[model samples]
Target: MSTKINELSVVDADKFTVSRTITIAAPIEKVWAAVTEAQHIARWFPEHATLSPLAVGTTGVFGWSDHGDFPVRIEELDPPHMIAYRWGNSNAAASTLESGETTVFRFTLETVDAGTQLTVVESGFDALRDPAASMDGNRGGWDFELDELVAYLEGSE
Candidate 1:
């Protein structure tokens, strides 16, 4: 099967932030839930996930068999429009944002004639122990995971 690849751009070399954007063939609400809700998120992004209420300060955890669990907390939420989270370090055993080894993950959705435009921007790589390697890893991670999201959502319809 042919795969859809999202566009990735390095926003700042010094800050180590990268942005990825992909258009999916689904409504904004559906896309929002797929990104925010634990069940839908697990289908695409993580092996397993648990999210609290859709509000700021709500905490969650994303688990991968290899990486174990990474703690996450909602820093911002706007229903079907935007959601942002502070997630623990990918390269370390950080369970809290207070550990000072975390990154910001922001997902923004926009309605369009075709479907929804989803943009994911993950920053704070400079705080990691190995910024370059971490940026490369997450960049590839988003490319693979977002394609799974499109396939899951579009194929389900």
Candidate 2:
């Protein structure tokens, strides 16, 4: 058997930007709710999330249904439109870098004829304490997570 791992985008490249678009067959409202609401988010993004959707700074902790916890700070919010945040990768702690050095994650919702066009962009990673190994792992991880988002929206387990 071969012992090689697949990468999605590369984590420690000179550039740091990862963006993807997924069209959901539901209305913008549904997609927005799935992303904003704590319960809805828990269903797709995390297993549990404590969210404060007020007009000010909101925050929450998202973790896997069984393991992991990533604290998120809401930077911007607009109903059925956009939600931006600073996402701290809890799993990043496993590495030798500062876990607090977060990468920005943004999710925008647009009403399209096909439904809602959700765009996700993550950036801010010029350097990693452990460049070579970490980059590949992170790149692959994000790709898998994005695929999970699609499956979650598709209501497929």
Candidate 3:
């Protein structure tokens, strides 16, 4: 794994966003699958996931045993490069695909000499109920989850 792990934080608290860029010591394709494929994502991200035949408008659910299930929809896709999903807030456990205001979290991958550079930008927290609390929850979320991704890929876990 790359010794250089970048720590990212909210770009603008008023705007309600979280952004981070990290380099993983792995091929772009490997990183791509981890972020785009449900099965791979479940290993590092949510405890369980369900999605296949990936594409824009694809619907799926990401669940954490303690956090509850969150329904998500792929809002954008650019194969092996970038993908974005609109998901319900953690504060809204009952929120569904159509029921609540959602945030869009995007993952972008690029190949570098060392490995793959992944950047994540999650926005629209301002739209959710208890936006401050939601933003605060996710501020720590990307840190924990992305570290898991790094550990899973780097075989550190």
Put the candidates in lDDT order, highest first. Answer: 3, 1, 2
Counting only residues 3 or more apart in sequence or on different chains, how many pairs clash (N, Cα, C under 3 Å) in candidate 1? 0
Positional deviation of 12 in candidate 1, in angstroms? 3.6
Q: Each model's RMSD to truth, in Å?
A: 2.4, 6.6, 1.4
Instruction: Give every collision pair in model 3.
Output: none
Instruction: State the lDDT at 140 in candidate 2.
Output: 63
**Candidate that beats the other on lDDT, 1 or 3, i.e. the better one:** 3
Candidate 1 per-residue C-alpha lDDT over 64-136 given as tens digits, one digit per residue, 9 for 90 to 100? 9997888899999888899999999767546677888899989999997778889889998888888888888
Q: For candidate 2, write residues 69-88 as lDDT tens digits.
A: 77777877777698887766
Give the candidate number with the greatest TM-score: 3
Per-candidate local distance difference test: 0.85, 0.65, 0.86
Q: Using Cα atoms with residue i matched to residue i, what is each candidate's TM-score against the true structure?
A: 0.90, 0.74, 0.94
lDDT of 3 by residue, 50-139 (tens): 987798998999999998888889999998999999998766645776655788999999999879999999998777777788887787
By lDDT, who's the top model here? 3
Better of 2 and 3 by lDDT: 3
Off by over 4 Å in 2: 1-12, 54-56, 65-67, 90-100, 127-135
TM-score of 2: 0.74
- What is candidate 3's TM-score against the reference? 0.94
**Candidate 2 clashes between residue pairs 3 or more apart in a chain or in different chains:** none
